[model samples]
Target: MARSIKNPKKAKRKNKGSKKGDGSSSSNSVPSLPVKVWQPGVDKIEEGEELQCDPSAYNSLHAFHIGWPCLSFDVVRDSLGLIRTDFPHTVYCVAGTQAEKASWNSIGIFKISNISGKRRDLVPPKATDNESDMDSDSSDSDEDGEVQNGGSAAPVFQLRKVLHEGCVNRIRAMPQNPHISASWADTGHVQVWDFSSHLNALAESETEVSRGASTVSNQTPLVKFSGHKDEGYAIDWSPLVSGRLVSGDCKNSIHLWEPTSGTTWIIDTNPFLGHAASVEDLQWSPTEVDVFASCSVDGNIAVWDIRLGKAPAASIKAHNADVNVLSWNGLASCMLASGSDDGTFSIRDLRLLKDGDSVVAHFEYHKHPITSIEWSPHEASTLAVSSSDNQLTVWDLSLERDEEEEAEFKAKTREQVNAPSDLPPQLLFVHQGQKDLKELHWHSQIPGMLMSTAADGFNILMPSNIETALPSNDA
Candidate 1:
């Protein structure tokens, strides 16, 4: 179902216009230099040295704001094909805003469309160069340049918001039905909202804006639960079952919800109590309907089987500090990833669980606390992580550098980049510029696409180097 889309052959660096004895021109001559490696809290730029992002490093990149900052958001699985690779993409998502005032908070359902950008093939460098020159000469050539050079264009979004009573701590959309979403509020309550009206309005508004302007819903939630002793950041809907859910709270409690009807759920009051401290996050097993996992502030990860009892079936001391997030690999059922407050993350093979030796790999790259982590739906070995250090990193566990390949790469890039020898070989891409990155998720339908949210705004980008294992339209 998946295929590599990139040309393994690297692009040739053209230096026809370079002048001899010019140090300034030497750096600009190397356009195909690898992405500048940045290590937060360790490296600082000296005077006259500046950090600049190479535009060619990304296939597509866009940044936008939605009036208020959102701490949590979920990508809504759409009717679009599960493996969509077309350009000018459209994405649907739901985000719960953390507004300045409690009453100012709202749940925003958005449809972002017309996301156009460059592909890896370069569209012929000569034509692209000419188009860039024309764009620089005249400001009116912006639209024309986009059409002629296949350049990026500003994406547009249509949003329908529902007024809420409190600031939302976390939100998740049902995978089976994207219109039904649940939000955990600071008011110590979890509420589910049906957003069919907003989605319908957005679908209709794409053609005519006036038709969908007044469809915003301010109605009460279809159901609400206040059984938890405190608010939490953990909530996830089961991918295998239609309406099944598991939520954890700061009070060291976990609850399960079973769908009784389309709009109603029966939450079990007898909570699963394995974690001695706050439950930081929860993730359902992709293959097992009766199984799930939870990470806690007490630095323990527990595996639960609802059929067994209220106690966890197995528990492991997963980290030295609070485990902040977890991502269960859907493609590879046995792999589980966890992030911690100590800025380290680890991958554990569930099948290797024996006497607390399940951790197969661990990394301590980020200086600040790890905030979010997610496995790519399209690639089993690939995952993305965001941290409080204002970075979003993509990693591929299947990558390992042999001595021959490392020497070859060093020979090619030695003049352009001075990368540290200790850098992890599995690190594929590192994205900076965002402030206080809170969360990130890969677009399951769109190959290689990733979206991240931060204190400032949101970023949607696709890295140019990583080969997406998918049947790309550009091919």
Candidate 2:
């Protein structure tokens, strides 16, 4: 029942007539690129005739919850629950959640699948205990080559503490440290969980510290850098250097720390002075490790190159309102996307700058603030964005030119305002709930598949294509 306006001719006419000098009006006539549309065919059934389901649909339906606030997420190579490269199917996620009023949590891990294709059949892999069992059995053997194990081997692993009630605001994983690292708002601490260890002892130790414990000797934090005067809103580990991490706080300060060496570095050298309000999100570039990006409550996106000390590599006065989230496409580091409180999404090209980085493409698609944005790992041009307007938008940037060129093209197209519409039609709208959407994530292994979560506790998995077969009506 929902329809998008298709007014290419009008848009072109509007653009062509606009003054060439005004940058704002230049982007108004840019047309969206063409996308594949799934049409209902004769094979589609009308009533209860029992249609054969596509095997690919089953494979695309597997959705897993990675974390809570999930303010941010990422995927890595050869991760747990992920298949090998030869399989060509794996997805990793990093998400933030809160645990009651106690602490913030972040979870990062990888997922794998045996099948392939956009619509392939997916069967949950059977449980196997080949290597894990072998290691357990071998641990029980003494150094003398004699089996000293008797009663259940004393259960070598134990759960230290259970985090029952909290949510994670955002999470990130360092390629430098395969272990997961996340920032929690409730406890005001950056927690790192090691996957190799059976038990997470550091989290337990922090729990004790909050309870007035004097000594934290038994538990060790790889490094605890302290400069946040208040709750830290966002944190990211450096992909280029091991143990180097950066965090933004409520006080509007970004601090860089070395967790292993206990050394702290401050890069506040720019007159930019960072954000005017609290910082909400930050991300490091996938292609160049030294370059990073940050978004704040003041509706601005700034790219910082640590080598330059405090000033941003480029700053763009992006949104009209608060900028909530930002992400860099893994395939094209030059391209980045951001979501804002203005119910709009903006895509920028890092290379397009006569003065500073400028907006290349923009979409005013939502009725409320955009909550999250994520780039597909497989395709740099494809992006998934979620908004408080209760909808998720999947954008194809590959078909569109960067903003500068788009602006020039639109200026020329406006001359044909009275012509027929040439703009592409809307592909699809995920219209399950009327409630605001909180998060959206794409399957790492499968292209054109994504998962969305809402404040109402509803999580839905949607495929790019949905087809149903019907009985032949010709008879």
Candidate 3:
């Protein structure tokens, strides 16, 4: 059930830390005491404030959840950090670092709170006896002996935190820990924070931690690569290998770093540059760690073999406009999708043979710049896309048929005359008829369900079965 609460005075008080001129102060007299100042931005806004605004208005004003209103400026740089959401109050992670100089400085978890909403009070109803009985069959052994499976485990919802005080261009979650790695567009060097220890300390101290403290004193950074004259736009941790990470910058260069040794490898060492313009996004193949793909502002997509260290192994002139995002299907290693500023999205099959390595599936639907694309982890062929046109679309890549095969199938279709629909019916889920979709993510635990956030500050969790082909209004 969804509910909204209104409290204007409380909303204002919640935002007091964000008010201009609020600053953090420390005293030598109390070295252990930490002073926290609420920096004004969107992430700090109470959920009640977000729920009160018109969804459409929220979308237009806060597109990308970027800039002053969205408060998404803070970047999380270390292994442990905290993000607050509307429900369950707070969420945190423990992060691992690759820095070698500070091997003893492990990442610490941190927490921040001032969340307000009825959703925070929501708890799943107590389980019935039959449900408990069913859960007993799936018991797992733990330190506390057998544990029931069907009972509610810890809540899993998390909101992204503004890790730094500047604009965040790239964010990557560490594979080993709950920690996240981020690079700021404004700051030149990378920083890491331990969110787990911070959260634990915050729980004990019952206070929020300061952002710019000497928190990473004991952390480890594998390597710190320098030489990019422009802002770094993307950073990705190799899922297949620990301590190996890659980053791309606005100058159209890709840098590979070994976090522990601080060794740097400039992959683009030749004139056959991967992209003509800045590399907007890059993702390592979930299946093949040695392989990865990069999309650029030049409207091109290049697939690279990390070992070659020079030119891309395969290249495709993907979109008419700059490609902003790339997402790999978790279930299929060779399947991927790209979103572009031209308001179109293309799906590619890495396994398909091309004249010179081309995209397999090309989809153009959004009329405005497509900002984000996400592939469902649970469903192999399902994909979710969001754009600046204030729209979110769920695409089924399995429905795509090759042109030649489609033609042959059409000839047979004429003979049959009454063929069943080849396109599986789709469930177009909408939230209050508003569509300024900025980001959408499928539940890691739940199949056929996902959540979406809009620039308008409206976040919704909707199940795919919400709109089935039923005669009645409710499915």
Cα RMSD, model 2: 17.6
Candidate 3: 10-residue stretch with minimal lDDT? 10-19
1-475 in candidate 2: lDDT tens per residue?
0011111010000100001111111111225622111211112223422211122222123222332323334443333433122222334343443322333332433232322322211222233688646534532422211122223221111112223123445555566555545444434555554443412233222121211112212334343434456565567777667756677866677776645442333333232357777777788887786778898887778788877878676677888888888888778887888888887888888888665646778887566788778887666666777776555555666453255754465465443222113322221223322134566665554445455544332233333232111111222
Candidate 2 — what's its lDDT? 0.47
Cα error, residue 182 of model 1, in Å, equals 0.6
TM-score of each: 0.85, 0.58, 0.56
lDDT of each: 0.76, 0.47, 0.46
> How far is each candidate from the true structure, as Cα RMSD in Å?
8.6, 17.6, 16.4
Ranking by lDDT: 1, 2, 3
Rate residue 51 of model 2 by lDDT.
19
Give the Cα error of residue 51 in candidate 2, in Å: 21
Model 1: ten consecutive residues of lowest lDDT: 14-23
Which is superior by TM-score, 2 or 3? 2
Deviation of model 2 at 463, angstroms: 2.0
Question: Model 2: residues >4 Å from true position, as ranges?
Answer: 1-59, 62-96, 101-167, 198-221, 259-272, 355-357, 399-436, 443-453, 456-462, 465-475
Q: Residue by residue across 1-475, what tens digits does model 3's lDDT show?
A: 0001111010110001000111111123444743333221112433322212211111111111111122111222233222111222332332221111222222323333222112100112357999766534543222211122234242222222323423334445555443444443334444433345444454556443332243444334333334565665556667777656667777787766555532333333232258888887778888887887889888888888878866899888888888888888878877878988877788777777365554767765566777667787666777777666555556665553455764574475232222223322331322222234444555443333344443333233322132121122222
